[model samples]
Structure formats: C-alpha cells, structure tokens
Target: MEFSGKLFIFLLLPLLQISTCDAYANPIYHACSKNFTSDNLIQDSINKTLSSLLAKTSLDSFGISSFGDGFFTIFGLSQCRGNLTVDQCAPCITKATEEIRTLCPNSAETRIWYDHCFLHYGTTKFFGEPDTSFTRVFSSGLIAADPIKFNYELMDLVYRMNAMTVGIDEKFSMYATHVSKNLSIFATAQCTRDLEELACRQCLDKLSEIFSGSCKYHLDCYVLSSSCVLRYAVSEFLNLPVSLSPLVFAAGFLAAGINSNLTGGHGFLPRSKADVMLNQLPEKSGSPENRELTAGHLSTWPVIGGLNHFVLVKFISGGLTAG
Candidate 1:
C-alpha cells in the first residue's frame, strides 16, 4: 500500500503542474502584421495609442482611439467579452495590453486574443467593416455520442438564437440562449457597435457557415473573427443572464412576413404580407422594451476588432466525453 501511494503521487504531480501552467497562460493567439518600421515617430505613436487604450479600461469594456498624424498615426482598440463585469474587464484588457507589447514589440500592427478580451493596434483604418479573414476555430475534440441527432439539435438552437440576436432593437442585441432535452446551450454573436443591423447579421452568418462546416460534431466550439465571434458551449461559460424566452420571440417574428433566408440558409417559416403588417401594430403602454441586455452594461465606445474563447472540461461515464 505504501509503494502504490508513492506511485500515484508521482503520476498526479505532472498533471497538476500542467493545469497550473494553463491557468496563467491565458492568451489564445496573437499576430504581428508584416508591416514593420524603424522610424522612431511611428513607434512613439504606437506607444501613445496603446497607452490611451489602457487608460480607459475602467470606463467601458470596449473602446477605440487614435494617436499621431499622417504616416505615423496608430489606431488602437480593446474589447472584453460582453458578459464580463467592469471589474473583470479592466484586468483582462490590462493583461492583454501587456501581452501584446511583449509578443509584438517591434511590429507596427498587432492583435492579441485572450479568454476574456482582445486588443488590437494598426496603421490602417478598420472600423465598420467585417473582417472574416483572420479566424480561429477551437473545438473540444470529443465527438458526440449521436452525431446526427446532436448536430441537428445544436444547429437548430444556434439558428434560432441567431435570428433573435439580429431582430431585437438594441444597440448590441448579439446574445441568446436555449435549453432542450437535458442539454443547455449558450450562444453569443456580436459585431462592433459601429456596424449596421444588416452588416452585423451578415457577419454572424459567415461565422455560422464556418462553424457548421468545421465544428459541427464537437460538444463545444468557438469561431472567432476579426470583426465578429460566435461561440456555443454545453457549459455556462458566459456571465450573462439566460432566459428561455427568446425562442418564443423568434417564433413570433417567423409567423410574421420577415424574410426567412438568413445568410447561412437557415431560417424559420415565412409569413404573408398582411400578417407582417398586423404584427407591426403598436402595443399598449408599459410594454416590455423591445430588447434586453443580458450581458453587463453596454459599452458606449465603438469597438474595432474582437474574438471568442472556449474552455473544455472533460468527464467520463463508461466512455470519454467532454462538455
């Protein structure tokens, strides 16, 4: 018994050390643009831009700023996950800023993504446009027990949530959740606040295509782009509130004449013009707001670039599984 205990301790020690290392290494990925400069003026502008972004970390979870002029100008921005509290967001952004400085010290343009936030600085203007080029897909690597049934259900939930996210009348109506058959899925699809509703919807549609094409079998997955992000997980990774009400709201819109053809060709039933007009009638006073902010307070500043993160936790029940 003493020898068996000693062997067990030796085996478990390395796993504990790995977990501790992962906890402290939060950055998902980072990129430094091919553009480089030895000019001191450009470096000064980059420094000032990053400093300004770090200074406003407490005021809002998302913000953008520019420093310097002409060829030496730098545009910088930072955005935290919508569900994070201000207290959580500040430190996440601060850490991201420090990481980018260390990782891309001499690059004139750089972006870094972490579990809870993203930081970016560049010489070109990149606001209001959807950037699907730079993307990362993270998966749990554990296939579902019943891939066909699981994929169908997961896709259906994600499609419904996508519809609800775009139709609501909020500055950032980009989050939704659903629960079915002992499985609960939380999803969020968001774009920079500067985007129009149609533009945001289009960006999310592209993300859905990437997810369906590549990550359909994984239990939890995330698709992160430069301009938008889509994430779904069995575990409750987001700090936002979850209400089972969005399903009903989306159904009502479907019953109306709203277009059923979303970007990725997933949609609800279409209705007649008369039904749509009737649904548009004004409601009585004291009606609930058209939108709900499940996440923390909305950020007033415009966001430039963003990404999403996924954390996998495994379990076993006569077989290997994860959620």
Candidate 2:
C-alpha cells in the first residue's frame, strides 16, 4: 500500500499505547512448562545458553545459541523488533533474560515476549522451524462503518507485507496507509531470523488465517504467536519517525460492544500449569460456563488525548497478559 497524504497529519500525536511504549521492560505474554529441572548439569546448560544469547544482543537484533552436549544441551534464540536500534534492543533482551528467570524460575523450557523483543529457550532444537502451538488474539471491538471495504484493504496490506517479508533477508515488514479520508491503518509482520524463507512463510500464514477469521472488521486487531505476529491498528503503534495526532476516528467505535470467544489449547505445553505472571496480572477466567470476558472487569478502552485510541483486545484461551 502506498503512503497516504493525510496520513502525515496523525504523526504529530504523542504515542501513549502500552504496546508501543518506549520502556521495553514491561512483559506482554509468556508460556513456560510446569516441570522444573532437578539435574544440576541441565540447569547449568540453561544458564550458559541464555548468557551466550544475551551477549549477542549488543551486536545485532537477532541471535541463536546452543550450549552443552547430549540431552543436557539447551537451545536458545532472541530477537528484537525489526525497527529497534542497538540501544533499544540490548536492554530489552537483558531484561527478558532477568524477567524470565524470575517469572518461571527453573522451567526446562520457556518463551517470553516484550513489546520490543522475544526470547525463548528449550532442551529441544526449534531453530528454522515454524511454531503456532500457542495463539493470542487482541481486537478492538469497534466495528468499521464499512466493514467490507475496510477488510478488503486490511487484507491487501497484510498479504503484501507477508510476501515482502518472506522474500527479504530480514523477515520483517511494516507500513501505513489511508483507508479513507478519516481512517488510516498501520501494521507490521515479523518472524525470527533463524527461520528460513519457507519457515517464515508458514508462521505468517497461520497468523493470517486468524486475522481473516476472528479479527474481521474491528478497527484494530492483532494476533500474537510464538513464531510470528500480525497487527493492525487505527493508531500508529510502530516506532516510525512520524508521530500520530489524535483524530476523531469514529464515535460508534467508543461505544462498541465486546465480542469474545475461547479457543482451548495451550500451545506446545497444553497441559502445563496455570501461567505465572509478575504481580499476578489479570488472566482469562478458567471457567467452562463463563466463556466471555465482560467490559466491566476484563475489557476496557484506554483513552488517549480525548480519543479512544487503543485496540479492543480479547484475551483468547491461553495464559494471556497485558502490560
């Protein structure tokens, strides 16, 4: 999608969304095994593997390392968002290493996501592979005035980005365009650098399917997974040079009703224990009868500069959390 002329106007607004905050230390989501290692050798390998991966964060935005021999070997991978500078990426990874250790303690394998970076480690080799084992959906329940047209344009932007990311050396893409005079969208797609073209394509395709199905006409929506992430918002969430100004997007959006659903399956570690988060962040209620999250407790629209600026997020069936 080409840049829209009016799109430049929104760039002046201050970025207030939690997902786009500059402080990258805030944890977004994580998945870890309930099982902890009792062997000293295996625990040593995990520490070595994580330290090696953390060291590389200063050099580039992506790194993968394996430490130890035989079953004791620990494989680790770390990557910052595609647009981050070394200064921004390094500390995010550093904090992730510290936070994961504190949050999960001695789990054999774990994965953590911050706004600017992702870190994962396990005894098994998962490099160059696509994993959709766990999925989380965040949608702004605000429906578009013209749902059909908005979806057509949104898919166009997403598919074009997917094509570009897989074809490039850096498997990441972001863009912004005007859907209408009063409406604009900013989106991004990314895969771990360890993923080859085929693996990256596979991961992104799974995210696309979720976007096509559950995230149809919402003004803003994003699906997060272990291997890839697909997100689009009415406001600019990326770290582009331009600052978005507060604009009257649509009044009906502020009053939109919550639409929620539960898809049961806990990624790779489905039977793992209930997710352990810092400060015991609110999680989707674990009830067979109460399947939906009401706006009274779990749902909210955080206002920014007199505008309902943030996405309407739905916590899917997984250990999901927001910073």
Candidate 3:
C-alpha cells in the first residue's frame, strides 16, 4: 500500500521521516539462497580461507589466494577510500565482515559500506563484470542550497579523482575531491582490481550514472555496491586531503531516467505517477524552482509462493507550498 505524502510524515513525527527497510529484494539474492552454503556448516573452513588471503597483502595489492588444502578458491577484496592506508583499510575489513551479515540477515551474501570502507563476499565468481541489479539507492531530506554551483565544484573534483584511477597499477578505483567556493565535495568510486581497466571504468561509469540518477541534488549522498561506491557531499564527510586523477579512458552509460522537482530540491522516484500529477519539467537542463519535496520510506513482505512481493512505501513532503 502507498500513502499520501502528508499522512506519512505526521505518522513519523519528530524527524524528516526518511526510513527504509528492504528485504532481500535482489533476484541475485534468490538465486544465491537456492544454493546457499549453510552458515553453520561454513564455520568449519572459513577460518582457513581467511588466514591464507590475509597473509600476503600489501599497500597497492589486495590479492586473493587459495586456502588450506586447496579445496576452495577464496577471493576477498578490501577497498577503503582512495586516500586511505593499511592502518585504515585493514581494520575496516575486519569490522565490516561482522557487521554486514547483521544488517542483511541470513542472506548467503551481503555488502555493506562504512564511511571509510566497504566489503562483500560470495561462493561464486564476482571478480569481474559490472552487475547493475545488485544495488540500492538512498538519500536524506537535505539538499545543497545551490545545486548548480554544487555540481560545478563536484565535476572538477571527480575529474581529478578519475585521473588518479587512470594511473593505477591495474588496480582501479574512481574518486575525486573539490572544495570550491566553500562548497566542499568528496566522492569515491572503486571496483575489484581483477577487472580489466576498460571494465573497471565501465563499472564505475555505471555507478557514476547511478549516483546522478539517485542523488545529484542531495548535496550529501552516497551509492554503494559490493563492487564500488560513488559519493559526493557538500560537507567534509571524511578527513583526508584527496589527490586522485581523472579517467583517461572510455566509460559510457546505458539509457537512463531522471526525476527532478521544482520546489528547490526533492527526491527522485525511479518510477512514479507524481511526475504525472505535476507540471512537466522543461526540455532543457534546468529544474523547477517552486514546488514541494517528496521523500519516502518502504517496507516489504513476500507473497505468491516466493514469486511475488508486496511492498509498502510511505512518502512524506518537506513543504507543500502552493504554486
């Protein structure tokens, strides 16, 4: 069931009311569950796998090696923000390993992002290729006061970050930082190093598009995946002076859809009839300037013998000024 924008906020109270709780909504989750290696059983050999991969890792190389007795091909990847070091990346991996399962619950695989790092694992080969369906997008109610200026500063920062990625030793990540005219932005993009540079850039380009699709107006937002994360915010979310380069490669995007609101800034629904209810945006690149913001949260339940799921999203408005 869906809720009217007004009813949703009053129910939430005390806050802007942007809470999201998703089930294992991924088709990949279903496929993995059908072949899940019971967690109780994994306890026996997971230690051996962890020990071997941890033995020979270095600053530039986070290599995956086989474990004791050669029974499993264990691959683990640890990606901290591009500017981080062993001191940061190492421990982040340890904590993320424990925390992600708790967040996702009983799913055979999971991915979680901390401000400093991200982690993911599976029994299958996920070392290469970009997977779009395995993703989630979230944003807060706040928006940068001047998105045009924000976008200008952000573009320069990400371009530098892309350059740094281009000079990598075949291990790739996309990242950038720009503190322009007091509108600071820091963002990062990364992928498994095993992927060829072309594929890595392509994967990251897909994420860049996803970031713009989901949170371009947020001023403080991030999109994370097991493979990479794209982030940009107007505040100093991290405490490092980033020095990365822009991509000297090709990474194109597939077809995309965008949602914009006229009331300063609002949430973009990948699918919605709200766009139907409102006046249309101009064919040019500008957004509307005097409308309402719609933010929302969702909860879901399974139905139809696992073939269908029922979802309930409650949308809230920050302000409903009349045009």
Candidate 4:
C-alpha cells in the first residue's frame, strides 16, 4: 500500500506540473468533438455523437475523421498564421491537437488556441453557452514596468479598437492596431453573431474586469474569448494574402444584431447575404458556422499570454460589466 501511494504521487505530480506549464506553450490550433465518451454502449449516445461529427467533417473544409467506429468521431482542426502555408498549418494543428488532448483527456471538451491553430472537442458537457464555462481570460503577468505609459497606451488602444469595431460586421471591424511598436500590435475583435451586440458587448465588459491592473498597454498582451476575442500581439496578427493580389479571409460576416424586423417581429434582420450564398463560396474559410459565446453557456476557455500573477472571478461570477 505504501509503495503504491508513493508511486501514484510520483506519477501524478509530474502530470499536474505539465498541465500547468504546457498550456501557453503553443501559438495556433482548432479543436472540435462530440459529447459522451468515445466508448458508450448506449445507442442514443452513439447515434448523436456520430451525426454531429459527420455534419462537420463531411462539410468540405472541415473534412475531419473519427477515431472509433461510426459511433465516435474524434476530430481536431487548426489554421496556421494566415501568412503560413498549408504545410505549416498542418503541423501546427497536429501538434496542438495531440498535446491538448493529452493534457485534458478528462475534460470531455477542451479548446487550446494558439497563434497558429485551434484544437477543440465535445466529449463532456461543452455544448451551448457555458456563460462562465467557455469564456477565456488572458493577462500580461507583469506589472507594466511603466504604469503611466502602459495605462495610457493600453486603454487608448482598447477603446480605439472598440470604437472602430462598432456598427460594422467583422468584415470591416478593426479591433486594435499597434503602430511604431516593437510588434505590429495588430489586434482584432470577434463576437458570435447570436449574441445581441449588447450581449456581446456585455461579455467583453465582464472580461475587462479580469484585467484588473493587467490591461496596461505597452506590452505584448491581450484578452481573447469566444464571445469576443481581443489580441495585442505587438505584431500584425492578421495576415495578408500569399498569392498575387489575392483575396483576404476576414473572420466572416457578423450578424448585425438581431432586430425584430421592420414588421415588428415578422421579417428577419439583415445578415450577411453570404450566409445564403454558401454554395457560391469555394472554401470553408468564410462559411456561416457557429455563433455561440461559450461552450456550455457561461464558462470560459483556458487563456494564454498573460502575466504570471493574476486572478479570475470564477468564470462569469465576477461583477465585471462592459454592459
């Protein structure tokens, strides 16, 4: 018994350490999976899981695969920095997906995003709005070496981007731009179209509270979340086309918040006509996919690129309000 206990701790300690340290080690990723364990004899679980995974996988760009039989669909995706070639995107996503899964196998659902790819899954209860569940928090981990300069720049950039982000859809939305700085400091904002602009704004407002004193500008740090993703990479995070005068892939048409319609509740609000013209589009880059804020309704996702010493109000519990 004593030997077993000792061995268990010896093994568990390293695993815990790895989980804490390995999270921010990557730069890009994509992750998606279904609910329920991969091996459930239950017929219903098998059917639903397979269907959801197939719906996404067979969908052109997301042509992923399931590991188990028709019942289980184990899938993960990623994109390289738009500047990177398809070859680079492959490795970035592959490595991140494998590593993230190893880190949180018990999570059922986990998404570890990086500058290169995104890895996600749906094994546990990650569907719908986690409100506090799928939300993400980021910090600088360092007190602005110069508080005054940091505060001035950070606040200015955040507000400027926010102001520019209003009214327009993601196509023209500009979140933050870092000029004459070490890194291009190009940051952008994205919100799932389902949330009313106000609701989306509120989510960002709450996320701001997590910054506490960390939002000090002047550094390479930013907050990114599902409902709203914000970044300040000190570099041009958005990439231009690789081919000659080729097209750019904007995040996609953001739904102009849902209006009850001119008929008081009859007609639908105007969305990206692109939503209707899916067939016309060739690639999956700008398809109308998902538009939910959090995975389970209120929770947040794990965060990357932040200062070491920071605090997060249990997901959505904090009295943070941009609303």
Candidate 5:
C-alpha cells in the first residue's frame, strides 16, 4: 500500500505541475464600436474575412483580408509577435478571433489585443495609415535605480532599435539588448508590415515619446498602439534567437535562480525544468552522429515548452481621429 501510494503521488504531481504552468492567454483589452450592427450578410462577410486572416497569418505572421461590398464590407488584419513560431502564432490568433467575436458580438467595428497577437475588423478602411489614437502604456511597477539616467539610456536604446528595425530586410522587426549597471534591458520595436519604412519609423518614434512622457521612471514599460508596439524589460522576457534572441543566455543562467521563486518553491515547475530533465536522459552508446542528433533536439525543447509571463498596466486616453 505504501509503495502504491508513493507511485500515485509521483504520477499525479507532474500532472498538477503541468496544469499550473499553463499561462492564461486572455485579451488585455477590447473595444467595440456602437456605430453599426451586423446583419446576416455583414456577419457572414466578417466570418469570411476572419477565416482568411487565420489561413494566411502563419506565413509571415501578418494577414489582411476584406470581403463583401457597400456598407456590409468587412476589413480585417491579424499580426503576431515576430519571435513566435507558426505553431504559437496560429493559436494566439485563433483565440483572438474567437474571443473578439463573443466580446464585440454584433458590433461592426472592433479591436482586441492579446499577449502575443492583435486583431482588428471594421467597416472603415484603416490600412497603410498609422493609428496612434488608441494607446496603452504598461509599467513593470518597479522604479528604476536612477530615474534620470535610466530614462536617457532607455530613449537612446529605443531610437537605435527603431532605426535597425526599419532597416531590416522585409521582416520589419528589430530587438536590442543593452546592459547598464549590472542590469539587462531588452527592447523590441515593431510596426505592421503594411506600413512603409518612413511610416514605421514615425509610428515607433511617436510611441517612444508616449513612453517617455508617462513612464520615464519605470524599470520596464510598454507603449502599444494599433499600428506599432514598443516594449522593454529589465529581465529577459522576449524569446528572441541567440544571435538576436535575448533570452538564450539569460534563460540558461538566471532561470535556475528565478524559476524557484516563480514556482513558489513547490507545487509547480518552470519551463526550464524541461531542459534539466532532457540533460538527465540516458544517452545511447551509439555513433557520434546519433549523439549529435540527440543534442540538437535537447537544445530546442526548452524554447518549445517554455512559458513567459507579462504584467500589464494600462492607461487609456481619449480617442483621436485616424491619421
């Protein structure tokens, strides 16, 4: 009886841990326009537009589609963070579409923001134009060690990253890491691919100004708009690649120290625990090529399984005319 109870505990514990580790991917905010109601034709058009976006978004992480004619026409766009794989991007967008439909219901114009993706659909055409009217600024809730010095460094880093991002081939994504006073700063600036280079730069610069105006003392902050997003953190929160990936060294090193705290010292396990388990797996006494293949698999498992957490502090201002 004692041995059976112990085995049961061992099996059940991992399952419980797995359940707790799954992060809740909910919409941070949503807005529905009371301007128009959707009839059957408009609703069908909306459905078709959303389906097209879901079908094509996985290719380059961006999709735009329009359907119907006259007042019933529906235009939609979906975009995912650049660092996410198609597997990750697809699900985030799928969930956004599902939730936005329920949240906004019959409203003809609506937008929703999730942790990894954003979706928008409406009767009005909004492509190519920058939408800075609806903005949200989030802070990490921790103040910088030196507000003045940190603000200067933060702005400089953001400007440099924006320049690099606008110049990237066609991907239109840029991330940069800066270390100051033993603190690491990870920043990513991105614009919708529909925008031209000048527009992207202007959109990011305007977001940077918004961040500087309101949250200059914050250790970490995010300025988000319908057309662009800028975020930076003291800890490595982004899953960028090693050459461009901010979390590689930080995840490998600080994960051990931080994971325990995140898990409350018991009951749950952090995503990096997968790496430790993979390393402990018994190796086959096989050829060098076989061993190399196993090693390659080991390196990628953590990225696939890892979970990231984000805390949002939203400040909503009055809406502006679309520019």
Candidate 6:
C-alpha cells in the first residue's frame, strides 16, 4: 500500500503541474484581416504596439493604445478576463501576443480570443469604439431534456448577470442557478473595459437575442463579440472555485447519464440567412437584424463576422469545453 501510494503521487504531481501551467494556453478563436502589409515600417510599428500592450498586462487586465504616427501607425488592445488576478491575467496576454504575431504575421489587423484573455490590433484607431463586427460562437450540441425550462432559467440567469454589469467598474459579471433537479447552469457576461456601460449593454443584448432565438436549447453555448462576450454551461467553467451544497452535489450525480452522453464530437450547422447575407455585403454594410420569428429557429444561425472572417464552432463534449 505504501509503494502504490508513492507511485500514484509521482504520476499525479506532473499532471497537476501541467494543468496549472497550461490552464489558459488554448485559444478559442483568432481572426486575421485578409489585408496584408509588406511594409517593414508598418510591421515594426505593429510589433512595438503589441509589445507595449503585453507590458501593460502587468499593471491591469485591460490595455488599449495607439503607437506610431501618420499612415504607419498601429493601434492595439489587450484584456484579460476581469475575474483573473495579475498573475493569472498576464500570462494569458503574453501567450496571446506571441500566438497572434505568429498566426497573422503580415495581416494588417487581428483579433484572438482565449478563455481568460483576448487581444486585438489594427491599423485603424478603435480604442474606445464598440465593434460588434466580429463574433465567434461555440455551442455544446447536447440538448437539454427539458429545453423550455432550461432556457427560461438560463435567460433569467444571464439577464441578472447583465444587470450586474451595469454597476460594476469592469463591466463584467457572472451568475449561476439550478435549472432542474439534476442540472444547473453557470454563466458570465463581460464587455471590454473600453466600452461605455450603455454600449456594453447593447452589445450583450444583441448576443443575448441570438442565444434566446437560436442557442436556446443548448446545454452550453458561448458567444464572443468584438466588444463583449456572453457564455453559459451546464458545468462550472469559471476560474473561480465554487462550493456546492449537499443538494447540488446530489443533483450532479443524478445527471451522470446526461454528462456521459455529452462525451461526443462536434459538427458545423448550415450557415444562417443572416450570415449568408453578411458575407455578400460590403464589409461596412448593416449589422444583422433581430429576426426572432417563431418558425425554423434551428436555421437561424447568428452572424459571426462583419469585416473579417470567423468560424462557428459547435462542441459536443462531456462538460463545458470552451477552452
């Protein structure tokens, strides 16, 4: 028994270390502009702008700045999730800066989203502006056994979170609720610190409309907009530790079968009419309209991008797998 315990400790130590170090390593999505820059001066400006943004991560979770002058100037922004501490947030931003530079070496603009942080840079000044132009949405394809009740509880939780954002300094909030005897929902809503409260609310409301209309029945879904993000899952995905009551713990065991079935794969649904039209329009054309009609709801995929291209990822997994 002593020997077995020693061996288990040796094996488990490395795995725990790896998980802790790489908790925020995987990026959810990245967007690169089709436009490329061959000019060395512009490239150098972008490099400096990103480096500055990375340095700012040491002080605060949010940073936005413009570097250089004239046509060669570059603008950049980097932000870690509001809940993260400086130690947690800085590494994510550092990883993002490195990955984005490698992924879009010559693109004039880029945006990368990770579970804990996001980075965006461009030639144009977008510091305080709210841009909902690009969005990447992920859905856990698992359907709830009680779709109507689950959705109702989810909307209530999300709306309550939204309200929390209004008074918070960081424009971020999280909320959770037990949706059923055997299931619970955890959710978060956040806007980039640069956005005004009203702008944040509008951006989230737009994304919430998508959730209510299309992703209503999903067991988990997260929508990331250029200006704000909203996410919910059947399992807790936040970095914060949660202590469950005895009743909640019992419910989790009862939902074992549903969680087991969630260990599946992913598939891309057909694009929505809004996405199709957005693709056809000039990059500057109108945003997606709120078309929440009652029929064919499954076909109503939300517009995922405006100026740049984005992927719509649907994950069918055993738990909240947004990372």
lDDT of 3: 0.40
Poorest 10 consecutive residues by lDDT, candidate 5: 1-10
Q: Which candidate order results from sorting by TM-score in descending order? A: 2, 6, 5, 1, 3, 4
TM-score: model 3 vs. ground truth: 0.53
Per-residue accuracy of model 1 over 1-323 as CA lDDT, tens digit each: 00011101011212222232242256766778746657888888988887888777556778888888998899877777654556667787878877887888788778777666778788877776766767767666667777777788677756655664555332232332333556556556656555566777887888888778777777677777666777766664544333322111222234342334322212221122223422442343112342122111112211211212211111111211111
Model 1: which ten-residue window has the lowest total lDDT? 1-10
- Superposed Cα deviation of residue 94, candidate 4 (Å): 6.3
Pick the winner on TM-score between candidates 3 and 6: 6
Give all TM-scores, in the order shown.
Answer: 0.66, 0.68, 0.53, 0.44, 0.66, 0.68
TM value for model 2 = 0.68
lDDT of 4 by residue, 244-290 (tens): 11111122223322121111001110123223322232244332331
Number of clashes found in candidate 2: 10
Candidate-wise lDDT, in order: 0.55, 0.63, 0.40, 0.35, 0.59, 0.62
lDDT of 5 by residue, 1-323 (tens): 00111100011111111121131166655777745454798899889999999888867679999999998899989998655667778888888888888888887888887667888888878888777777766666577877887888777667656664554333233344444547656677778877777787788888888778766777767666778888777655554332332111111112222221111000112223334422433343233454355345434434322323111111112211111
Model 1 vs. true fold: TM: 0.66
Alpha carbon lDDT of residue 141, candidate 1? 63
Q: Model 6: how large is the Cα RMSD against the reference? A: 18.8
Q: Rate residue 95 of model 6 by lDDT.
A: 91
What's model 5's overall lDDT? 0.59
Better by lDDT, candidate 6 or 5: 6
Report each candidate's C-alpha RMSD, comma-separated, in the order given.
13.3, 20.1, 18.7, 15.8, 17.3, 18.8
lDDT of 5 at 82: 59
Q: Candidate 6: where is the Cα deviation over 4 Å?
A: 1-21, 239-323
Positional deviation of 117 in candidate 3, in angstroms? 2.7
Superpose all Cα atoms of candidate 5 onto the true structure and report the RMSD in Å to 1 decimal.
Answer: 17.3
